[model samples]
Target: MHDHARGLSSGAHRRPLAVSLALTAAVFAVQVAGAILTGSLALLADAAHMMTDAAALVVALFASTVAARPADERRTYGYQRAEVLGALVNGVVLIVLCVWIAVEAVGRLSAEAEAEIAGGWMLAVAAAGLVANLVAAWLLRHAQKQSMNVRGAYLEVLGDLLGSVAVIVASAVILLTGWTRADAIASLAIAVFIVPRAIGLLREVFSVLAESAPRGTAVADIRAHILGAPGVRDVHDVHVWQLTRGAPVFTAHVVVDREVLDGGGAAALLTNLQECLADHFDVAHSTFQFEAVGHEDRHNAHR
Candidate 1:
């Protein structure tokens, strides 16, 4: 009744993700050392962010690997949802990191005596971190479009890149103006910028977990197209949802003219229906139950 079409595997993204992970890991160590020596809150916050980015990349890489496994009887859809779960975890972690950064920034701002930051040391380390983040971001840029898991990692690295820039600017301000609070202010700005993106990613993850139709996809529009198929009288109980990004599934009960079934045109009608979905909606996996008009009336249990 339905075509079996596997979701696109995440294997293609693994190499770039691995490279980015290495780059982030190396930058994290350097930034941590710099933060300790400079006593710069902004540098410390960026280091923490980089550490989390490395972890997120690891999770994304593992999830993508698991998601490439073939479907079996026990797990008919294979492990495509693993990518979404990975993305969900990354999104939550990002929000938590932001909260920590915000709280620390506030505490620093309220203190009677500000921490003495070595702006020259902070700026040197921050510039190095910025260059590393830029390379990682470029590596994952194209891959992010194909998988939510990769997108989550890409966003984290991009945030880290921005954080590095903020640290550099803060350090420059402190060096030139002797304003110690610039470090705290920069940390606050980085936290503020990351929270919204984390929220947006979480919203997308929840929508998938809820079995909602993919974004920009309208159920009403799908129903209209189904009704347009030759021999189809009406469609009911139509449903659409996604297993992951770019992997949509559809199902419906289609009422057709009795003559079409009796005259042995059912096969052609089914093909037309399936092809209509494939060509117009880009949905390759669909199921349809064909019944002669009024068959639902006899059952009396249709939704």
Candidate 2:
């Protein structure tokens, strides 16, 4: 028996991502203006990060729409993997954006002296950005857990939120103490926050693209669980993996006792294996290939 349930629906992420894109676009404009007016590296870095956020949100929205499509003859898995592709793109963007900020910030720090910036204006714009980022992050908090695409979007927003905080702090230091280098320092700090998040997202996205087992699942543990099923003598060719966030596919070949196969116990055994995977491993879609000892060997040996 094979239970083939579809992956989770990503319709829930559309609204939150739309709201985030609108707010992030607004912030990006404001931050760009602030960066230009004040010549603040911290503001510029935040602006750049927000630009990536806008792009990420757009990708996330597209992925959500396509992922909701039904399976077709040409593409039996539907469009669910679109979310992973979106996540991978977002992660790569984050990495590139962060590295760009780091290099620019380093140049500014190594200069003979920091350029004069309009500290007061920087402070006001950063304050506004901080508020907008907070709202965007909150909106996507719940959806992030349900979809990898949403989670990537949330990480972008969250990184920007931190960047905004750094900008505000740097702007205030420059305003009160006339320490202009604080701008570059804050830019570096923002890069620090962005790198780790980008790396984590990339690892997960790559894992999915590679069709590797999810980090949370252990193949050995699954094999053991299947072997423990009644009337199952051995298990082999066991494979467990996911296409995306919630669509797990498990396939295994089980070698059962000859007595069980001859006594019409095959149906009962199939039910038990399916139920085991569902109850213990949260694996909803599974295929069990049953065999009676030497029967499988001879059946395939001739082929």
Candidate 3:
């Protein structure tokens, strides 16, 4: 018997992404203008990060829309995994952007001639970016918990927030100490901060794509629960994995006493198993194959 229990769709996060995207676009423009005016590598790096954040939000928004599509014959599971793909792209883009920033910062650091930095304009622009990132981060904070796509955008915004702070600090150091190298140092700091988060996000996206069991779900405990159910003698061939961020799917084979089938209790047994999965494991979709004792011997022989 198989039971399909639906969960909330990804569409709920669209508004947050849209709003964040608008804010990010505006910030990116301001940062780019500031970078050009101040000749500050740190400001330019933050603008680059903001550009990626804007792109990530756009991808996340599109993925949420695609993921909300209904299942059909050709695509029985629908488009829920689109969010995972969106996250993957976001992670890759962030890492690539960081690599570019790191190389540029190194070149600036090695140059003998100090690049003149307009500290006042850089500080003002970075402060504006900090405020915008804070607002965008607040908007997506909750939705990020529900969707990986939103989480990717949220992470990008957070990186941008840190980048803004780094730029502000670099501007201050330049303004107060007249140290131009601080601008390159701050760009390197932003790159260092972002790479770990991007790698972590990629690791999660890969885990989901690989169909590994969702984190925190114990397969052994789930098996024990199934064995504890009434009229079940043994269980095997268990599998559990997630289709997306919060949707877990499960399957198992059960060996049942012959009396349960002969006495017309199979339906009740299936219902009990479904309820066990839904209630205890929070597994909304599950499939169980019931068989008489010694069936595994035959199944193994065939295998």
Total clashing pairs for each candidate: 0, 0, 0
Q: Which sequence of candidate numbers ranks them by lDDT, best first?
A: 3, 1, 2
TM-score ranking from best candidate downward: 3, 1, 2
Models 1 onward score TM values of 0.94, 0.92, 0.94
Q: Which of 1 and 3 is the better model by lDDT? A: 3
Global lDDT for candidate 1? 0.90
Which ranges of candidate 3 are over 4 A from the true structure? Answer: 6-8, 296-303
Prediction 2 TM-score vs. true: 0.92
* Residue-wise C-alpha lDDT for candidate 2, range 1-303, written one tens digit per residue: 687553345566798889889999998999999999999989999999999999999999999999988889999878888998999999999999988999998999999987899999999999999999999999999989878888998999999999999989998899899989999999999999989989998998888878788778888888888788888888777777777776778888888999999999999988887887888788857988888987664343311
* Per-prediction CA RMSD (Å): 1.9, 2.6, 2.0
lDDT of 1 by residue, 1-303 (tens): 776554355568999999999999999999999999999989999999999999999999999999998889999888999999999999999999999999999999999998999999999999999999999999999989878889999999999999999999999999999998999999999999899999999998899899998888888888898888888888888888888777788988889999999999988988887887887787847998888987854353334
Return whichever of 2 and 3 wins on TM-score: 3
Worst lDDT 10-window in candidate 1: 294-303
| Cα distance off (Å), candidate 2, residue 250 | 1.1
Candidate lDDT (C-alpha), each: 0.90, 0.87, 0.91
Error of 3 at 271 (Å): 3.3
* Residue-by-residue lDDT tens digits, candidate 3, 1-303: 888765635588898889999999998999999999999989999999999999999999999999999889998878989999999999999999999999999999999999999999999999999999999999999999889888999999999999999999999998999999999999999999999999999999999999998898999999899899888998888888787888888888888998998899999999999998889888968998888876653354211
Regions more than 4 Å wrong, model 1 = 5-7, 297-303
